[model samples]
Target chain A: MRAVVVDDASPVPSFEQVRSQVAAMIRSGELSPGEHLPPVRQLAADLGLAKNTVAKAYAALESEGLVVGDRRRGTLVLAASASPETDRVRRVEMAERAAVRYLAEVGHLGFPAVDAIDVVRRVASAD
Target chain B: MLGDWLSIVVLGGLSSLIFVSGLGPFTDRMLDRWCLRYDVAVDQHGREWLRTQLRRARAWRWCGFAVGTVVSALPMYANVIDRNRAADFATPANRFAPWLLAAAGSVVGELLSRRPPGGRRAAHLATRHWRDYCSSRWVAVVGWSVPVSVAFAVQATQSRDLGWRWSWLGPAVALCGSAAVTVGLRHLVNRPGAPDGLDRLVDDALRADSAHHLVGASVALAGLGTSHAALALDLGWLGLLVGMGQWLAIAAWWYVARQETWNVARVRWSRS
Candidate 1:
């Protein structure tokens, strides 16, 4: 029954909350590999979130290999990878993509370079 | 002159009595029965979270009652300030205040009733709709202003005579708003882009449509009550029937509205 709430008040959607929380939990080893996540419908109802929100989050988790989906068995967290090198590489890639998206969004939003950096720094620090 | 004012008091008293005695219990029973029967917000899976929200909702009911009492009484205070105190007691302002209080109370009651107990999942669901206060439910952004603005505009006018013009105006506006809600809810439910599981979700919601229909019935009854009050204004034998009908409708509407609000409140959400 334990679940986390990303800022519900934030402009961020509930699915994003599910995605980030599940990811954070996996990284922290709180939800060990092989732990059965609650069924999407039940979890969504439990969280007052839309059912699709949880489904989307689960889809993301599955794609990252942090969780495994078996049609018959349902979804389960996979054991954490043994390779630190692979983990480091994945983290760097994620960070790079996030930076590119942030910069592009800032430029499009019409913020000056210095202001955009400040905004990024603030968001990063808050997170 | 005093006799005329007394008659108005008697009329208002009778109407209030019906609402308090008959409609109050009726609404409570309907709420219980509807909750037991279809359970529009049932989380076949989130049993524990559902229970927690119910508890919060129960607490909110008490809060609704308290807040409703205050809001309803405020109009009575205004009536007291008027030079025609006794006559104004039966004015539309005083009579309408209680119903508004009750509706406002329902919201507070609903929120209080659904507070989360603990645990990550429960907490997650409890806060799930927080963004709704900001974005998704933009209608809610104007929620408080609409009614208050309407009430103030109507009450601030100098006319003290009770007539169909103002009474009908209030309900007409309400009906229009409800119609908008029904249409919007229908559209949201119909969206094809909804997640694969949305069909089941909407199906579950639709299964309780009968309950929603009952709310419609309640509204119709309340309309009847207003019609009766309008009839009674003439101070004829017909007024008796009109007054009686108005109170009956008030009670019915109150019951139906209670059920609908409860149904809406039971929906537990997750991160989505």
Candidate 2:
């Protein structure tokens, strides 16, 4: 169990920090596949987070295939390479959602929907 | 035939509340206005608030929804009314029980109130995520209504002897469907770099605030109507009617209040 900080003062969430730090730990081999992680509720208490915040971080990890939850055994790390596609999909999904939000903002402010779509296209296509 | 016609119209009305609320389009308009006003590409405050509220609302709404279910089901659970006795309103107990449950469910949930004042400044501070939920909650509301309407149909067709048994099915289906759709929508639309999710975090709070006042009013009306209808019918078939009315009133009121908030937020955002 590593120390996880809840940086309410920063715009970045505690979960983002946890995700990055945990990834760093995995990369450095300080944490390894098959290693068990703390339960969400316990970790939240340790980190001074709302339980859901910890759960969100865990969900991100789980979705990335960086971790897998064993019904009886709790959440354990998975070999990062095993779910490379999951990582790609997650990234794509994040990009898509962000794009949608951006498009939505543009459309709502009295821009034409087609124009908003064109803007996104041009921006993405640009260097 | 008369009863069937009545239930269909009533159920249709309930379903309509889910669709014609204009919440989604209205929310989008508001968000656009906010973005234009701020002259910023991203809605930082809106996103922050939405993420926070979605998580908080979801956890709490489930609890409230559960309590509402239990309260609404009390009459049947207590055996104060049964299927066979549903249509016969000649008895005082039969007449009052279902209405009592409907009112209880609607009003009890209302006791947990959150409303925001509608104005430009108040709106400027509103989040895009809340606005998003305001725009899209209809999908959730309408999705859940499918099962509810089906269950109501089943309850509508059952013979008198099977009234009580079938009566449970409508709400049982509705409760489960509502929970599933709500959770699914939350997950599917969860915003990254945001807290909680999309709608539950920010807009739901404002929605709760804006519409909190209507819970009492809806409960009073639905409860009174249901009780009266229950008293008239010996078979308790009218429980469906009362239930439908209560759901419509609350859902519609929630949509309207949230939409207004969303609109104001957009207007303020545009000017600011």
| Candidate No. with top DockQ | 1
Q: Quote the positional error of residue A75 for candidate 1 in Å.
A: 21
List DockQ for all candidates. 0.13, 0.01
lDDT of 1 by residue, B1-272 (tens): 45545544664565455444432322434444544654444343343343333344333333433443444444344454564563444444444444444433333333232323333333221222222211223234223323543453355233445555554444443444344334433332222111222223333333233223323332432344345334423446865775575566556544543443424434533223
State how far residue B9 of model 2 sits from its true place (Å).
15
Cα displacement (angstroms), candidate 2, residue A43, comes to: 15
Question: Which has the greatest TM-score?
Answer: 1
Mind giving the per-residue lDDT tens digits that candidate 1 earns over A1-127? 3456544567777788788887888787877766777666556655666778888998988777677655566667765663677556546655776777888888898987789889768988999
Candidate that would win on lDDT: 1
**Positional deviation of B13 in candidate 1, in angstroms?**
16
Lowest lDDT 10-residue stretch of candidate 1 chain B: B125-134
> TM-score for the first chain of model 1?
0.59
